[model samples]
Target: MARETHIEAYDGPAGGWGSAKSVGRYVLGEGAPLRTTAALAKQNKVGGFACVSCAWSKPRDPNTFEFCENGAKATAWELTSKAIDASFFARHTLRELEHWSDFALEDQGRLTEPLKYDAASDRYLPIAWEQAFAEIGAELNAIDPKAAVFYASGRASLETSYLYQLFARIYGTNNLPDSSNMCHESTSVALPESIGVPVGTVFLEDFETTDFIFFFGQNVGSNAPRMLHPLQEARKRGVPIITFNPLRERGLERFTNPQAPTEMLTGAETTISTQYCQVKAGGDLAALFGLAKALIALDDAAAESGGPAVLDHGFIAEHTHGFEAFAGACRARGWDAIERGAGLSRAALEQAAETYARSTAAIAVYGMGLTQHRTGVENVQMLANLLLLKGNIGRPGAGICPVRGHSNVQGQRTVGITEKTKLAPLDRLKELYDFEPPREDGMATVDACEGMVAGTVEAFVALGGNFLRAIPETGAMETAWRKLRLSVQIATKLNRSHVVHGRAAYLLPCLGRIEIDRQASGPQAVSVEDSSSHFHGSRALVDPVAATLKSELAIVAGLARATLLPNPKVDWEGWTADYAKVRDAIEATYPKVFPGFNARLDTPGGFPKPIAAREREWTTPTGKANFIFPESLDENPDMPAPNPDALRLITLRSNDQFNTTIYGFDDRFRGVDGTRMVVFMNAADIARLGFADAGTVTMTTAADDALREVAGFRIVAYDIPEGCCAAYYPECNPLIPLWHHAKGSKVPAAKAIPVTLRAAG
Candidate 1:
């Protein structure tokens, strides 16, 4: 059964009565409103668990209710009154459950115990924990470690991620890939080459003192809702905000902070952006070039007039290299190419450059919009080039900010969760843990999928994620998944991944972020780093929803204990008894980043991890920040005779969605309701496609050998560029080829898939 879509215009400002009503409905709809209400009060505070939504850092001085509507929905969804046990599984077979929607599967509630898939009856039967672990460990030890893919989601804490990596390495493999591979792997890979640090330089305090803000790709209202508060404040202080996105997102245009009583009561709103540029999809690089070109031209004019220098020549000469080459490339880029690639006029880019020149300090913040392209790595480097032109990296109110999606996605990487060998401390692990860590470079997300499809990979072990839904080419991967020797899913709630099992699959229930995690010694709090590199302590105040649920830390240790032989070198049992041991091991592994790991949590907003570029000390190959030039304008890969009918399709997330989890059907700010299968196209594009006010249509992927087609999707007229169209992700993931990804980083290029649309029968 498909969801029927109803299209309408939504003129309301972001975060007003609309958000308030949504929060009320979501929180109350959880079947336990009173209990969920009590738990909501403790979210994002000093004493309570962190919001399991976006990676935005909690304020130093948090209000009574610091969580947003999306945060509330996440909490209520976790602490729901509904329950699912072996009885529920007994009632529904695997064939019957496969037909259920993602939302319906979640609505069935949390997993209670260990269950093993029975192929004979096509059902999952309750199994003993020891038997489950013994069988999984036997299978794991039986296979080549390189052939096993150990995947981690962002929802896990630093303690869990650290131990998870340690377990994988000790088991003799560096095949550790996480959710970051799909999202900001470009930032992690590109920033180090440009500025000598993978993390962002701008902190929350910078938001207060910034003179201007440049926002790109991400929709702040839906993705990082709490960011709207700072944007609103900056707007009130007269700090001009420039937004460059294909969609004139309601959050960028106007925002009414729901936390502000005066604004909420009076129905008043604040204008967020002083200017909005709807650049076409796959055009961020060209738009960035246009801005840089205008700035260079301004500097030329300033030199002729004997005026103050527009470019920071002094800083450029002292701390940066490759400026001349980068500048020459920008100069070589013609305005016609820029206009065609960026979908904006030269005058508009100049106007933006003028505003950028006027500001003493500015922060360039972007989201997945810039990262999920074939030129994703270059797109990030281009932003660094723009910021370096003004010496913005190590300044008071200027830097680059990449807004992360999950709560501790950044922290997980800091402690250890990556496929690349450079980030992991191989030398230290050998000295500290007395084991030979994997030396070879490991496989990323796409590599893992390719391995599975090629029959090179024999097992898949996931720690908290819907692997089946989150990745590209879902159908192909689903089929490849069955070929595995074993599939182990460590999760809290049951997702489609649990149902789509291998020869032998086991589901292990784990603790959620909102529930209390008490180890053998005492209650424990885990550390998580924010997008700005600040680490905070997260302690759950509410009780566990189920009696059988174990902490992720314990679960990881349990599997490690079962898999590895009785090795005196590692103490899996001791680490599970106390999480502090995990932190100690993490500090020892990366002493530079986590020197005072446990003690730093007492600080007001937690301690800031050291970033070399933040101090203007470049640790790059040249010992200086380098300006890299983009090889092309459009992010699209080189193709002979490009498809004339192709429209760049940007897969989006509904306001009610977080990753693959859908909280509800309404996309409030986007005027979308009742469906996630609609396509957003410009009014002129609708006419060009020979449709009147748009009708039901089918989309076919224009690239790759695969016959990728999604049928019965309606088209909605949006304020996007003529050649661009939009649709929700995971739904449209099948259309994107697994081979399509960022050039150097290998992140999935979901934002710039070339597609064609035709009327559906």
Candidate 2:
């Protein structure tokens, strides 16, 4: 049954009673009141499991109520009372369930036991874990090692990720495509080339000392609610907060800390953004160039007047290279081009530049909006360039922060969840496990999709993500996945991917992070690295939803034992039994970074991993941070001019959702309720396109070679840029071509799609 649609301007501040009410609804909806409360209490606690939401780091001394609204929803969703058993599968056929919405499919609840698709009945029948493992092993053994694609989700812990990569390498395949290939691969690619590391240098404490903070393309309220506390504190401290985004996000506009009883009870809210600049959907690079250009002009004028220079000349001379060429490129970018490309006036950018110039210390934060574009890598590098101009890196209260989604995603990469095979990690693995790791590069997420379409990929295995729904061009990807000879999904809940089966499909139910993991040795705690690179131990407080549900480590071990013939001398069972053993192995593999892994876990607040870039010790080829100068502002430099009638479309996430998981249809922050198929358009654009404010429309991609369209989208007039529009993803994912991705990063350019709107037939 569809709920009634409601649209109104949201006047309430973020993170107040609204968040509390949403969290309360989710907790009650889970149906196990006591258990849900207990489980939530255990989340983000000192010794309890980390929240499975965003990777925002927990406070050193976290309050009793440490979880946020999104975190609460994730917890409730995972620990829900509902269950999907063999009988539930028998009630519905694969074809019948295929038409269900992504939310409906997952809301069927936790998978209680292992299931295997029965082609005859077109249903998922119960299967023993051993039988499923044997079948998967047989299919894997039958195929060439290179034909198998092992996909990893960021939700997997460091231990599970390490074991997964080991299993893939032992099976003689380097095709390890992961969620990072779709999200922060741009940061992973660009940061290392520009600086010396792939990770951000900022710590949680950095927010306190910053004089100015700039947020680009990040909506802190929905993505990471915990971040609002610091931003609120920064506001109280009189720090200038600048925001650059296509849409006006409420979290960036103002916030009310629910934790503050006085503010929540009294209705007082903290003003967040001192200045908000609505940059065009693919225009971050141009805007950044404009900011840099304005800064350069101010510096030149200062130098001519024999006044204090705006640029950090000392930092540039000592810590960076290619400044001369980069500066020249920035200065050469004309104001007209910048204004046209960024959809911002020259005065607004200059005002932002002036605010940035006056600050002694500043931090630049960004999210998927900047990274999910054709120039995603360049967009990130440009942020780095902006920071480097005033020596933002390697200092307190200042650095580049690509606020990553998914807890432990960064940790997974830290523990070697990558398609590229580095010799150092390989050698370390060999020294620790006595196995020769593959040297060749593996397929990324896009490459794996292409491989599946080409019929070169034989098998597919996912650790914990909804692969089919998360990827771009869902129509093509769904078909490609079905063509595989074998597909395996190890997850807690049933999703769209489970119904869209391959020749032989297995659904292996695994324990969620909040559930206790009891192994042969003893109870174990898995470690995860937060976005800030702090590693902490997580132990579940609640029992598994079903006794049959296996831990991710156990499943990986079972697959390894069943598949890898004549196994090496490594003790997979021992490592799985005691996660401390896994930590020991991690220490052995990466001695310098993870030194004394077990010992470090004992330290309160966990140990912050050493970042060479933070210490200004650049290990880049130039032995210093390299400044990159792009030839053009356009993400696709060779692309044809955009259609005059076409609007730039960006896929967004509702406040009620995270990634592909929809908790509800409401996007309270944006004042959208009861629908996921609505598109946000400027009032002027709506008027120009001859559509009413709330008119229904069909959005069709303007791609020359491919025609991708989605119908029945309600157009909601919003305070957005004139020629730009926004829609929630997975629903809008069909319009983004798989081939339209960032250069070098291969991340889908979901935020820069060109689309034309027509009245619904």
Candidate 3:
């Protein structure tokens, strides 16, 4: 292939010349330097579009160059000058395009028209929007509403998301799963039970005064590079940052702000973390227990000596539940088990505890690493327990921060996109629309796949996403997708998902976030919420690439109109004509939470949504924060005994990748060049496993079936902890079974896969 593997040392600080060069290459290489350059300038700025890459909230006062390398790439990729229309689709058959990679399919450029799959010719032909919608509506009307799966990606704005979910509920199904279900569903599921809110309580501005930042799991450099600036500033202010991760991430270790003239001119690097501990894969729960245990031990010592209280007694008594049982459970877990399970020394755990105890306000930040495990829900709860020991939640510069990857993932979920029945406020929907909402639980990401495999899921409607590539068991999902009777995709561009169509499929082109959406009223602006619950308006940077393109909101409304013809309850036409009406309807549904929604859109840097947890107002059933006691130190209970010979495979994303979209094959952060078919292993493990450095090896899963495996992966010596290995995601997705997911959250346990390796023949 593209060179087996080329590993080198990447000692340079993150976000320097390397980041700048990558941004330059991507933006300039789009063949529309001026157009792409202008789009980058408008990103994250007032009255401009939000960055479609990551959901990091914007500062109250944004910089002139507020975008990061990933943001630049996403912006450039969307603002491409290339166009692929009906003629191009006619030239390429679906079977031929099935062989193309996801990146190659999207790189073909934007979908220019509504097209229907022609099974006889194995090609797609242009069709009128009304005709396509009518056909799709007819098919959906014929099937049971519960059998349809309505999926939305994070790229959808709040306006579109609201309408999209409403459409699904009105169509008689709660199968409203979105991109958030795949990534941060654990945070969403656990945080509410632990702290009475599904989202993190810390604000973007909280970084300025935070005493300590405990970063876990997430690599900010690749996922959300804009986060580095605040962390670097926190370091400059002498705030000690403690990091816990399996791989030594370059972003969490050191960062040089590319926007800072002095750093760029002098090539100066800012040390991000005071201490970095390499926690084993799927060891976050054990590590959290260790930290909590240390905190309790310190408190016990202080109590006897009449010293300053280590635990916040007043806060615990006033605003918490289950502290006694949780603390006792922590005391029972010995240091030996903690150290063994966490892959960290007692000294490191104690040091982290000390740092955490000393800080008046600390923010516990995490990403998919903590959430993508069998004990993902427990991982979040354990983290909350640690934060509660020092009363870190619901205060300025404190609490949890589960960083989101998609731009408006949290927003989409906030505006009623979920598989759960009660989360959508069915009561309000009925009161407003006078329709009976679905009460039964619906299909999530995994359930949707199972439904497809079982021939029960008749139709699949995706707003935007590479569903096949994003889901687990890629091979199985790819084949099962063909079982669907209808597959309707509303997207800005073509992707591999389009090629792997159902029995009948339709591709409807929609306007991109960067393109101006001129509805019947006038140019309309959309809104999105960041990871921190900050809501803001996003206007277009340029005109639509094609005249035939429609806004996502319009498309969803059009489909709803076709499906439920002559429905007087929902005003789909009015909502599509003017998006302000949609906002008004949203406010009508959640008035207290979204009052003056339309007027607030003009706020300079947007407004922060009200979070009950941030105000220490616990809205849980207990009316206070609750401490959770995990079942065991071993997060992966399904996993057998901890065998030293077995390797826990953790999936990673390259610096040049975003989700399933591969920008390039170069990952400067890990020193991987020109190839993604490589696995990172410790030097000792390499020798212990009897594999030479850079030698090709085949990895087979240790599951009961033992069918999941990948061959021809080069083993590169890395600095990871023993008994663990790392490889790029989506490439290794084939080895992950669809059933291997978190216990409660059902999120794919991608962080830790049991596997074994042997020399490739």
Q: Which stretches of candidate 2 lie over 4 Å from their true place?
A: none
lDDT of 2: 0.89
Candidate 3 TM-score to native: 0.98
Error of 3 at 656 (Å): 0.3
C-alpha RMSD of each candidate structure in angstroms? 1.2, 1.1, 1.3
Q: List candidate 1 segments past 4 Å from native.
A: 1-4
Tens-digit per-residue lDDT, 278-340, candidate 3: 999978878999999999999999999999999999999999999999989988998899899
State the displacement of the C-alpha of residue 305, model 2, in Å, after optimal TM-score superposition: 0.7
lDDT of each: 0.88, 0.89, 0.89
Minimal lDDT window, size 10, model 2: 422-431
Q: Which residue pairs show collisions in model 2?
A: none
- Ordered by lDDT, highest first, the candidates read 2, 3, 1
